[model samples]
Target: MTPSQLRSRIKDENFCKNIISYLENIIKEDLSWINPAFEHLISVSSDMESTIFGSVSNCIEDKENTKHNLSDEDKGEQEYFYSGKM
Candidate 1:
């Protein structure tokens, strides 16, 4: 799948939130090492921003597919939860 599709899938699965949470947890424990990482981040921000924006735009354009993917995933999760298989 395209990068945009992968991003949309991640968003639909709430993967980004989990990843952000994980990153926050890591940074909270090691505040001192964040500077070099933050510096590299700033340097890459511009290029990454365009890629992200493009992916979001693709997601928007294929919103119906994204919605279907999300709904089906939700259904699967719900079924698994109800069946005690989660």
Candidate 2:
């Protein structure tokens, strides 16, 4: 998925809630199988949620900061071009 999609999905409370519900069902329906797999699955999903949340938060917090970072790189490139030194 694109970053925007990932961010949007993570930000949707309903989506996260649905995931929680689904996970709960898995735990309830087949504790035997889920017990062995739940930890890894939960950890991976939690990590994914955190990553997506962070990216969205960052995008919202500092849209200009992201742009500024790129511009700084551009400035360096211009300097390199002017100096004729790779």
**What are the Cα lDDT values of the candidates?**
0.79, 0.82
Q: On residues 24-85, what C-alpha lDDT tens digit does candidate 2 reach at each position?
A: 99777844755777889889999999999999998778855654666777878867876989
Q: Model 1: per-residue lDDT, tens digit, 1-86?
A: 89898778786647877878988997779577669879977879978999999999897889656546666778777568779876
lDDT of 2: 0.82
**Candidate 2: deviation at residue 79, Å?**
33
Any residue pairs clashing in model 1, and if so which?
Answer: none
Candidate with maximal TM-score: 2
Candidate 2 clash pair list? none
TM-scores, each model vs. reference? 0.26, 0.37
